[model samples]
Target chain A: EAGVTQSPTHLIKTRGQQATLRCSPISGHTSVYWYQQALGLGLQFLLWYDEGEERNRGNFPPRFSGRQFPNYSSELNVNALELEDSALYLCASSLLPGQKNTEAFFGQGTRLTVV
Target chain B: SQQGEEDPQALSIQEGENATMNCSYKTSINNLQWYRQNSGRGLVHLILIRSNEREKHSGRLRVTLDTSKKSSSLLITASRAADTASYFCATDAGLRGYSTLTFGKGTMLLVSP
Candidate 1:
């Protein structure tokens, strides 16, 4: 089975611009999650979508938003991006949300560089 | 404000040696997982230890969790140059569901051949 896949392996944007990243989860997975791994900063949860619904979010701002499609793929959008927004955006997929011990497979991630 | 905090921040060891990294969390968790990232690439799931389980092993990796201490440790035996990567510990907590993983800063491991 193919694993989670992400688009635009690397991206470069400027301040105040908008950036969009994409992720396709593994087959048979129902939960899609997004995380931001900034340089020197660890992986931080951004958003969680389950069955096409926004289930939970992290401590990020509203500018960081995303949605899960019917096929379980997800897109992360950042509006009015700041230089600090430059980071690696990762997407993961799980069999189900809230199921303890289920491993989440991650994509290669899209590295967004805000200039 | 990270949930799991790995100690030492960074480590450098020789091949055939052992590497041990520790993680501490503040809140209760249903399961704690470990992941390895090569360079800045995507993270790969390494192991997961449930709250009820104290110890688990996968090939060359050994993980131990102590709910009482609210901490966990990951040990890699006979480390190789391929094991040179960043290791992070994540927690699955809260009632909102287990999909969200709060990861730590991770420990950067460098293995010399």
Candidate 2:
């Protein structure tokens, strides 16, 4: 079976513009998570969706938002992007926690560069 | 701020040698996991150690967790050039229903042949 997949391996956008990143989970996965790995910032959780509902979010602003679809695919939308937003946006998937297998599998990530 | 932090920030070693990296976290966690990232690519899960467990081994990797100190160590035996990557430690802060991983800045390991 295939692992998590992400689209647009690299993305470039101007400041104040909006950006969207996509991810597809493994066949039987039900949870999707978004994380931002910025320079010196490490990997910080952004948003999480389970069963198509937003379950938890990190300390980012409202501009960083995302949703999950019925098919377990997820999309992350960032509004009014800034230069600091340039980082690797990773998407991961797994069965819901407490389920059979909860170890998350990650995607190659979308490198978003805000100019 | 990140919940976990890795020390040494970077490490360099020769092939056939052993490499060790350490991670420390502030909050309590259900499990601690290590991941390897080749450059900026996706992360590959290496191992996971539960809070109740002290140590676990996989192939050439040995991981030891100390809940008392809120720290963990990862040891790679017989390092190789292919082992060069960024290693991160992640802590699962959620309880039974949900889990969110907070990762450290990671330690960059470079093993030369």
Candidate 3:
């Protein structure tokens, strides 16, 4: 089975612009998570979506938002982007909680560069 | 905020040697997982140790969890150049239903051949 997949491996946007990143989870996975890895900042959780519902979120601002589709794929949209928003955005998927396999599988990530 | 913090931010070792990284978290966790990331690419799940478990081993990787100390350690034996990557420890803070993992800053391991 294919692991999680992300599109637009790299994206470039100017400050105040908007950026969108996409992710498709594994075939049988039902939970999708987004993380941001910035230089020197480490990996930070952004959002968690389960069964098409926004389950939890991180400390990020309201400008960072995303949604999970019916097919379990997810899209992350960053509006009014700032230079600090530039980072490697990763998406991961796993079996829903209470299932046997809850280990998350991650995508290659989309590197967003805000100029 | 990140719940876990990895020690020795980075490590450099020779192939065939052993590499050990430690992680410490603040809150109670249901399970702790280790992941490996090559360069800036995606992360690969390495191992998971539940709260009730103390030690677990997989292939050349051995993970030990100390719930009493709120810490965990990952050891890679006979390391290879291919094992050079950033290793992170994540904690599942949720106790009941779902779990959202909080990752640490990660330890960068460089194994020289």
Candidate 4:
């Protein structure tokens, strides 16, 4: 089966501009999660969407927001991007909650470069 | 932060040897998972150990979790060049019925032939 898929493998945006990253979860998956892996910053959770609802988010600012569509695909929007916003944004998908031994599958991620 | 922190930020070992990495988290979790990420690639799930479990093994990988200490360890035996990558430990806090994961900074392992 095809794993999670992300669009525009790489993106470049100028400071103060906005950027949008997209992700399509694996088939039959209902939960999509966004994560930012900035250089030397590790992997930070950005948002979590389940059943078309925002379930949880990390300590990131409001500028980092995203939404999940009816089909379980997700879009992450970074508003007024800053140099610090440059990072590899990853998307992962997993089975619905309450499932036993649930494991998340990740996409290759989009490399966002903010100048 | 509830994120896990990996020990020995980086490690170098000769191929065919064993490599071990440790992770410590700040909060109680429902499960702990290990992931491997090669350069410029997405992470690959390695193993998952639940809070109730102590140790588990898959192929040549062994994972041990000490809930009392809120620490976990991963051991890769007979390592190969293919094993060189950054290893991260993620915790599923399972807070409010959400399976959200908090990841560690990761340990970089380099295996030379």
Model 4 chain B worst lDDT window (10 residues): B93-102
| lDDT by residue (tens digit), candidate 1, A10-109 | 9999999999999999999999899999988899889999999999888999999988888888999999999999999999988857766788999999
lDDT of 2 at A111: 99
Q: How far off is residue B60 in model 2, in Å?
A: 0.2
The true-versus-predicted C-alpha distance at residue A34 of model 3, in Å, is 0.5
Deviation from native of the Cα of residue B17 in model 3, angstroms: 0.4
Sort order, TM-score high to low: 1, 2, 3, 4
Q: Estimate, for each residue in A8-54, the C-alpha lDDT of model 4 and write its tens digit.
A: 89999999999999999999999998899999989988888988898
Runs off by more than 4 Å, candidate 3: A98-101, B96-99
lDDT of 3 by residue, B1-113 (tens): 88889987999999999999999999998889999999999999999898899999999999999999999999999999999999999998784233458889999999999
Q: Which residue pairs of candidate 1 clash?
A: A98-B98
TM-score of structure candidate 2: 0.96
Q: Pick the candidate with the highest lDDT.
A: 1
Whichever of 1 and 4 has more lDDT, that candidate is 1
Off by over 4 Å in 1: none
User: Candidate 3, chain A: TM-score?
Assistant: 0.95
Candidate 2: tens digits of C-alpha lDDT, residues A1-115? 8999999999999999999999999999888889999988899888888888888888999999988888989999999999999999999888765442258999999999999
Spell out the clash pairs found in candidate 4: none
Model 4 lDDT tens row, B1-113 = 64799998999999999999999999888899999999957999999999999999999999999999999999999999999999999998865333468889999999999
lDDT value for candidate 3? Answer: 0.91
Q: Model 4 off-target regions past 4 Å?
A: A98-100, B96-99
